[model samples]
Target: MKTSRYILITLLMIGCISSCSDDFIEVANKETLTDSSFWQTEDHALQALTATYGALHGADGSKWTFFEEIYVAMAYRADDQINNTAETYGRNLASFSNTTEDSGPNNIWKTSYAGISRANQILEKVPNIEALSQETKDVIVAEAKFLRAYYYFWLVTGFENVPLVTTFEVELQNLFPEQSESSVIWSQIEKDLTEAEANLLTEHAAEWKGRATKGAAKALLGKVYLFQEKWPQAEVKFSEVVAMDYALLDNYADNFNGNSENGPESIFEVQFSGDRSNGNDERQVFNFEISPYAFGGWELFFPSKWLVDEMKTDVDANGDPSERVYESIFFDDPKSDMYSMEATAKIPYSDVAENLNNPNYFKKYSFNTDEEFYNGTNITLIRFADVLLMYAEALNENGKTPEAIIEVNKVRERGNAVPLTTMTQTELRNQIRHHERPVELAMEFGIRWFDLYRWQRGSTATESIKSTLEAHNKPFSENFQDKHIIFPIPLQEININDKLQQNPGW
Candidate 1:
């Protein structure tokens, strides 16, 4: 999240409190803080807390590591997307051929741990700040805890069996801690989120818009439960989120625009801004990384033909093509309702027949080439649409198909798609697994991969995963395995910590 330029300056001024340092004890100047001299003022605590918030950014350097891990490792592997012929990263992920030494996983592992280290520093120092009120201390500590849990969530889910380090004071040997059981890691996640829910405000004021909120904590906690098959607990947490003032925007695309960030629909988001007058670079390069070469960008990732065909069948409440389908995709076809902004105006993409290979680009992050340079689109982590779908899944599992359809239709109606009034329990379950989530939340992040993982956890594993893959020609017969569900622990981490073991079938 981009704070005011002053806060960003505060983050840079407070140097040497960083993950790159091994000494962690030697920075001695006023700008370089130490344990004995720092944490005495409210400003000190605030600036340190701001640094903890900085850990949430997924992009570091120019690589966009956060997107690389979630999008490449998970989303690209799923059936909904495919890499363009020129992009190796997406193709490798889709084919299950990415290695442990792959930079995507390695970067996520390093950056996430770096965030945890910063957060631990805050938790260690914030409690001792007598200058700040108890309320202020609680909120700061809660935010740090949430950040720790957030980082760990990416770790355990993406890498599983991660080092459960929770403190700053560690012996040299203790630095190479062994991997903890997935269960143990999950317990720590729940612990931090529970405390976060208790302390974070229901809503942050406009100036503090992107800070974690009660809804964010509850929603994340519920997702954790859903991952673990604790359905009743998931239902309760999602119900609380649904009860909040959050609502879907009138237009589904509003959620992706920079001018309309922190809307009622966004429960949690990574705030990005293109304004570089500030010393910090908070711009998200998602579009730059994935846009067609024609847009002066890398043609890295695009929707599969299977996905494009799925959109053609989808219809709105008005019995016309779905607004979401049109809003979500752009390809070289006049019959299909998409246009290429990079192409000449008033010219059908079909006119460019020689270049057509069903070239589909994600229109969700589309922006004007003339107006602004860098993309400022906020990446939404949780939205009301997800809460509705998760709640509907819980209802369907509990044999409340009637109630489930009502919730599912809320998302459909927002996309201007017709709502289903009737469906058997089996159909409701299929609706969630196949239709609703893929159409509404495609290419967002790990949501699709997580859906596939959890679908296999059910009794209908055969019917759920393999069938979908086969029907869509998604290379289930190519290289995916039962053990391929989770990624291998990065080889570099294994080298550093001999106590760590790789996941099965790397």
Candidate 2:
């Protein structure tokens, strides 16, 4: 176990910032030490890894400074309520006309590289630590490789072909290169995850519960295959996860219950332990829920009205309310409490699609326990439910429609959807995309975007992007840009590195 002492050390080493301008590309090379002489011991190696993970947490958690939300938003237009930051990124994707001139894309590019540099620095040094056990060293290197692969995956997902940096040495030389092909980038990702699975322990050692495991590496590999539409390979990987011993929470809502941060269902989640007394602003998820009640801005990701209506019309055999449907959606109806009840009464959405906004905006993240409205809840990345759905998609794509439905209906049965004996490929696909996804993975940043990419439904992407802007009543051009499919390199990167070329049509 890397002692919590390292976490304290990282907090103490608050490097000074000379520039605070948003336009500045937070370069990694500037602050990074030029020589690896200081990184020699096993403790030193572990400290560096802690520093990388610590950076994953931002100043007060006010904004996910390290995690790039823009890339995920760009993947699907429909899944998010776009704001000033996301609009710039999505505009590029919707119209597909972004250049290096775009701001949001530039931020993503810079942050991702910063993380890559941190991971690479650890990889380059950890191998030389002779005191550490070979198993320990291998696991640390695998962890760094996993992080690097994650950064590369995000880069490819957003920009398609991007520069792939594997070592920290290159940064010391200020050597930047042109973008590589997506296939080449993915090959590196595959290599890293393959190595990670081989070296990483399958289960988290108690001290390492929140850290990545062999399962995470396998699941990520599965997702990578899914993105490439390699149905057979994807099916095999997802099946492996299904066969794992993980179990879903008895209640669908319990999986995301903030109190159960690392519940049995969570494969991996960004860990957030609330430290508000220390001035931590770790409450965005809470803020999202408290909007209507606290008289703060109602920024809840209201389920699309179309989705809620679909659920109301859907029925299961026992006829109890859909196990997946939450109470926030049902207040207005006569049989339900749409008009009268106060404390738990359903709140009305005021967007253009208010009636269409599914009242069932996920209550999973909605607070039921009496904690500060929005403190740190672990945001799940992969879970048992997701594995089930992916298994369904992979099977469907591979022409095993019956097996696919069986896999899908297992989840549906849990969520209280009537078990279907069969569904046409198109119907199964549509159901998963429209209802299952939004409800199952709502606001789990980027599920909507990824789903859109997989389906090749550009028109829905356009409408979804438009709806978010229009819902905010923001102005937009009538035409969508195809170049928006990928984000632009941050303008500062283009300015600093002469060889770094911009994406098309910025």
Candidate 3:
């Protein structure tokens, strides 16, 4: 089992503070922690780092970082997802009509910074612990660097330019730091990941399975280079990761069905648990958000018709519908089953009157057998198939289209989809951008949205965004502007810090 030591320590610390007497004057009370008392032991360092990881879910328990608003902000803007609910912030984001004051962006900003703050605290204090072995301290520091880079990646990608706060001490001295250039932020992320790759273990023990690994750092660094169009550099990094002991699971659905979490395919995943005892309530709510209403889900959003149409275009080697299509969506397929029900008990999604006219509900993360809304399924951030596809993309851009097809075939082989034949770099690029990636990685993370931003035509990033949205006949196509490429800095943040500036058209 993944360790719950971190969560238990947090609860114990909270209990310590709560139990302190109101009658007594507070002056370095031993029961209640101060900086002098804490940060003195290796256990303290572990506790602090654990809290940093916990921030991936939420700083406070109320707003789950990835499962709630952040997921909406990331996925809803893309052409693949349709927001069917009446939530104003969600609707505004989906339509590109969101402003600086939208709660989606604001909560994401807060959660990411909260994680960075905890990471910075560890970097500041973990080195000073007298009892920690140098080897252990180095690993802890490396992990902190990885986490800092992870949070900053989100900030830079979502908001373009953001404050690059590294040191807790420096942040305390100047709380209202000016935003760094996006290039500068990317450089820092590269530096952190480079160092992390050098120091992180190639694999962690079962107890530490969810922590960042060398493979995770290299994969993320590869992604950073890919975004910058550093094709050769990206290829090298992904090549190194592909050489690691990671492979696509035999069954694609096992990646999300909670049966194979922290399994061989996972490079990094945000840890969660269904057991709410010991202050561990980090389970995700994707099942509730994405499953069909007939299956007891809220039906907040459904797959766009464009995505369903795209997935259906590909066939397996047997000339049947692609297994990926059956695995990815609860469609009108007679072969597909819901809630992992038995074949005899299966119900076609089209049979339900409520879902008859709807496009399709996501089947990727909805692999539960019960009515429980929250689940312990870890949200995979990076996996081996993604690495293979990314490696293929980099190789294609680097003028190795034939070799790139090999990697793409590896992913397609696992999905039981037909492999591509030899093609030109431009042809292969279009394939990877349009067909390979969307079908393989839809409704997971922000892959589609991020791909739209990075896949440029002439000069502006919006060329790809505008063309893709228009091609899909998205309602937001008319509303999308060049400035919508990056979100506005939250108005709440700008209000608190006068030095902060919003993105141009906000």
Candidate 4:
């Protein structure tokens, strides 16, 4: 029985979040720590785990900051949206001219480590409680381990060689731990996720819906394998997940429909509730239901010309454009009330594509309904379509092109689009490159840039990221030197921890 203390943990954790900018929330609340004498029971353990989940969604409801760091900072470094605005870290990251001192990566580093600290605290404290059954304790610990690995996954992916810490204790010398090698960090992620898979429940009861499960663990472990290019392992893990209860929702747009959240398609979602008084709202001022509401709604993201044109290439068997194009982007539709910040007016997009003039807005995170507006829309992290594509990529990499297209068609069929004909491995690889990932998941978090990185990196890597950027007309491709491959370890970390050395090329 989870305690009413869930609210208490949220209040404490919110104050503890490290803010990127000077201005941040510091709630007026009673001291929670001193009064927390009832933490020995099952309910207390549940509240602690809930706190970890809260940490996942920007510590203490500092919504805009986390998205700015991981989504905007890292996402811009790859070819996705055109560099539209100069505010936040958008232009610098979009141009690939950012530094270790940049606030985006630095704040994310602090937040990521803070999350790890909380998970470590839970792991350390939960086992000692005599009130929890062995079964309950194992499950609780597994959740903590999974959350820890998730934070590290972001850390490792964003900044390759991060200092790894498991225990909550920090000695004088431990504040600035040295950067662990990427291989070493990968091993730790694998170990944590593997244990998490073993101990977590196969399925959660209705009350425990979004909590980590055996399916979530397997899906993530499969992704880790995909990132490392461990094809056969990735394929096997993805296959196991596909056999489970997860499936694609009937409509592509349903994934973003707030009422349709936590459906079978969702492997993991960063849950949000618009409790404005509690400061738990998602902070989605950028994508509002009605444009011209709230200072023009900012309309932060402008879809790239490449994204729009590519989407136009594929239509349904009925010759109508893919529903995803309509669902994912909002252009000059007179029916829509989207505000174009560039135009400085409350107007729909220009009706003509040729004259559209960077007037596109991302609709995925836009309003679903009045009550389920901005702050309440849960962000989908991994979905069944994404996993299917991962499985397809792994299969293609391992000389299984024909079989790979089967999964590709599975996704295409749901969208009512034309399926691929028989093609050689080389041709199928090109198809996945041009049609698959970018179309299925555009402007949905950082998938675009992540795909760009995976395709253009390392010895086994094929295709030129430079060419893709060129094809998209990104102005910064000329200056994106070889060293821009991964983010530099934040300079602040090096200044503090002498053991931390700067990544060579940065």
lDDT of each: 0.74, 0.61, 0.80, 0.73
* Full candidate order by lDDT, most accurate first: 3, 1, 4, 2
What's the lDDT for residue 98 in model 2? Answer: 47
lDDT of 4 at 503: 79
lDDT of 4 by residue, 1-506 (tens): 11122242531322244668778776634544432453578987887787777665555436666566556765676555765564455677777778878877776677778778778878888888899999999999998999899889888877788899998764566676777998898999999999999999987787677788888899999999988888899999999998999888888878875667777898888776554555444444435522322323544557777777787776788776677777777665544333343343334444334544356656676653443334556777888999998899889989998899999999988887888879888888777877778888887778877777777764465667777888788768887765676778888888888898787688
Model 1 error, position 316 (Å): 1.6
What TM-score does candidate 3 reach? 0.92
Clashes of each: 0, 34, 0, 2
Ranking by TM-score: 3, 1, 4, 2
Q: Per-residue lDDT tens digits of candidate 2, residues 248-357?
A: 77777666556556667777766665444555544335334323323232333444455455566556675645667643243234333221112243344332124432
Better of 3 and 4 by TM-score: 3
TM-score of each: 0.89, 0.78, 0.92, 0.87
Off by over 4 Å in 3: 1-28, 61-65, 87-89, 170-173, 278-280, 340-346, 353-357, 369-374, 457-463
TM-score of 2: 0.78
Q: lDDT tens digits, residues 393-493, model 3? A: 89988889999999999998898998889898888888888888889888888888888887752232224687789899777779988888888999988
Better of 3 and 4 by lDDT: 3
Off by over 4 Å in 1: 3-28, 59-63, 278-280, 332-357, 369-373, 458-467, 475-477
